[model samples]
Target: MLSDLVDLVLPATCALCHRPGGALCAGCRADVTACLHPSPRPAVPSPPPPGMPSCWVTGEASGALRAVVTAYKDEDRRDLAPQLGRWLAPALRAAVGQDGSARRALHGRGLLVVPVPGSPRARRRRGDVPLLAVVSEAAGGLGGRAVVATVLASTRVTRDQSGLDARARAANLHGAMTVRERQERAVSGAVCVVVDDLVTTGATLAEAARALHAAGAAQVLGAAIGATRRRVLVPANSPGPAG
Candidate 1:
């Protein structure tokens, strides 16, 4: 639909291999799949920032997966949204399913899948919040009452996180996010899964969790499509990097 229209305007090229055809060629898609964990697994950052929620990841954020994420967010590759959503679905399911409290909450209060808010500056530059569409798509595939909520808001501007170490990243994001006042009632006593595109230092997710907890959410779990390999322990059965 929209991807086809966009492709017609600006010929599709694989984000990783630069092959002309689609946002990602079949070969590159296979390589990206190889990066995925055999199953979703815990992704705890070393020296995890305070307020960090229990988190899970679908794949290691390196090579093909990382390139795809960068292109989707910064390089104007909106066509990759469906692929990103599919990749994130497993982690989202695992985050909610493995938590006893989350599973129980599903029957009564329902589930909230909240994407970490994008910066106003970034949104202006990109013309959209790419994570929102992907999060909605993933949550929709959960087959039950998973609701995508844009409840969190960026409270202040922060410096770029690229060069920052764990501590600096935590400091930069501390007090940077808050739940919207109008949405506080919905968040009260809700079980929320705060999701992100990637987990490096985990500062962003921690901040989002903190804000949700402050607003009275009963539980706040975390999920992401990928995580930096150094901070997360990959499973032994996972396949080696793709050729």
Candidate 2:
């Protein structure tokens, strides 16, 4: 078949390292998993504006994690979604306490994984939303029991969040997203996990959460492929980088 011929010729090179057999080579896959693992201090949720929901950061946002997330998100390298989702799965599993006996204790709880819908502009540029791909792959890895929902939509087009501080970002997205009337039933009574490709100022995720909550989602928790950590920059003449 033509598909088989293409596979034979290209051999599916790894997205991270270009290894000619797997989606991600073993070394790069290990690095991705290590970068996304839960940190000692779980990110706390920031209070968002009305109609917006709160979001928590699970892992520290260092240069390494940010680089991987940015590469996939901004550069349109969607082939990395599966590998990124694989890295994200373990931390998400841990956040919900899926190891050992806890897994059964949480079974059938009806957790819905809803990706934060991207703008039409972004989709047009990228050809697809990265979070959807990540969430879909993650759902498959989770064995298909948990529901992966895309019940929210962007009702208004908004400016890109790049170059905006937290406050500006929040303002830009205010009143920009909404849950469609038909999809309300899907979110109601479900513990919604809002997934995104990255969280910089947390504005987008917060808005997405708010939309879901307004639609009657029981509880909304935030998850992402990565987040931005506060970095202390050392000036050239600064003493010991300031305590």
Candidate 3:
């Protein structure tokens, strides 16, 4: 309520187009939504990271879409979480569909949506793991069918992933995450989909999958709002955005 009051008084402009309204105005929102893949499909990063699970993304990481995500993640635009979470829903739906447990879990079992753990350094600088907030919103939009459960945590500090190649990222994140011991019971039989704001190199998701599986996750999949298209050679028939 207080934030809304502030927004009404200040009238912030769109982060990308800078139109006076919100962090992402309707016009710019439409353009970013246009970039969404229409339907989620497998998104495989170049030289795919080891143990990478099936991943789906809403759009390629670039243009207005990337700007929105970057603003939400790095520019302290926490207000964009709802819009970005809405964008993530499609990919999350696809991921849930792929996980047999999720479909059935809606009946009686529970589906846990987990976000990739960011390093403590990043969290301290960013004020929060923005993805977790986004994932919680996305799960709420899924009705009572799913719930957000942040069971994973960084096991040790690691170097910043920015500018790291696929190999370097894989090495840096290797065993960097683990399911908290106390939370093992919650994850043991849960159908989980590891989520991130964007997929680059697929290293983080792969490492996340490793940790989830280590804790006895019934099934593990990945979904992201966007992915980098750099050198990710998708086959002609693959229904995903690539250039």
Candidate 4:
């Protein structure tokens, strides 16, 4: 198969250390950290610009999760996405369970998994949308009849969020997203789970939740492979300030 050929030519290796084996070597994979059982929280609500999709945040963000996500997104390491997704699968499933307990709850329900659309510039530079791939892979691991939909599009280009503080990152994304009208039907009345590689200040995910709700998604849940920790500041008069 073509996929086998591609794998043959470009063997899988640990994205962090280039150790040959699976997508990641056992040791290196172990090094990739995760935050287990993050408490679910509502996504920070933003004002709808008249007829926008509803959105909600669902997990606590942590520094270790953010680091792994950053390594995957900024480092052009697609191989790591699946591994990261696998690690986060349990948490994602739990979040879904919280919404309902019905059997086949997610089956044939027209669940649309819309990853936060990345900027064209970042996609071009990275060679692919890592978050989309990761979410798709995660869906596969879910081992159910849930369908994954990719219907949203980034209508405007924006600057990369890397290296920017949370405030700046949020400002950079305002009004930078809009769903394609033709693809709007894919999300209508469906349980739309907004996927992202990571969440920091949550501005990006918040905006994405808004766009999906505007598209008529029945319920919008924000899910990321990892959450980012906000930097803490220490006072100048602290007893033991670092040199």
Name the best candidate (by TM-score). 1
lDDT of 3: 0.84
For residue 121, what is the lDDT in candidate 4?
Answer: 65
lDDT tens digits, residue span 111-185, model 2: 677888777776776653547887877756555356777787788788877887778888898777888788888
Candidate 3, 66-149: lDDT as tens digits: 989888777778888888889898888888777667778755677888988766765886644558888987778666568687
Candidate 4 Cα errors over 4 Å, as ranges: 1-12, 33-68, 101-105, 125-128, 230-243
Clashing pairs in 1: none
Clashing pairs for model 4 are 42-57, 43-56, 43-57, 52-214, 53-213, 53-214, 54-213
Ranked by TM-score, the better of candidates 1 and 3 is: 1
lDDT agreement of model 1 with the native: 0.88
Every model's TM-score: 0.89, 0.74, 0.88, 0.72
* Poorest lDDT segment (10 consecutive residues) of candidate 4: 45-54
Off by over 4 Å in 3: 1-5, 126-128, 230-243
Give Cα-based local distance difference scores for all models: 0.88, 0.65, 0.84, 0.61
Please write out the lDDT profile of model 4 over residues 139-200, one tens digit for every residue: 67555555666666676777877787656766777767767788787777777666776566
List the candidate numbers ranked by TM-score, top first.
Answer: 1, 3, 2, 4
Q: Once superposed on the true structure, which residue ranges of model 2 sit more than 4 Å away at CA?
A: 1-8, 11-34, 37-41, 45-59, 98-106, 126-128, 141-144, 231-243
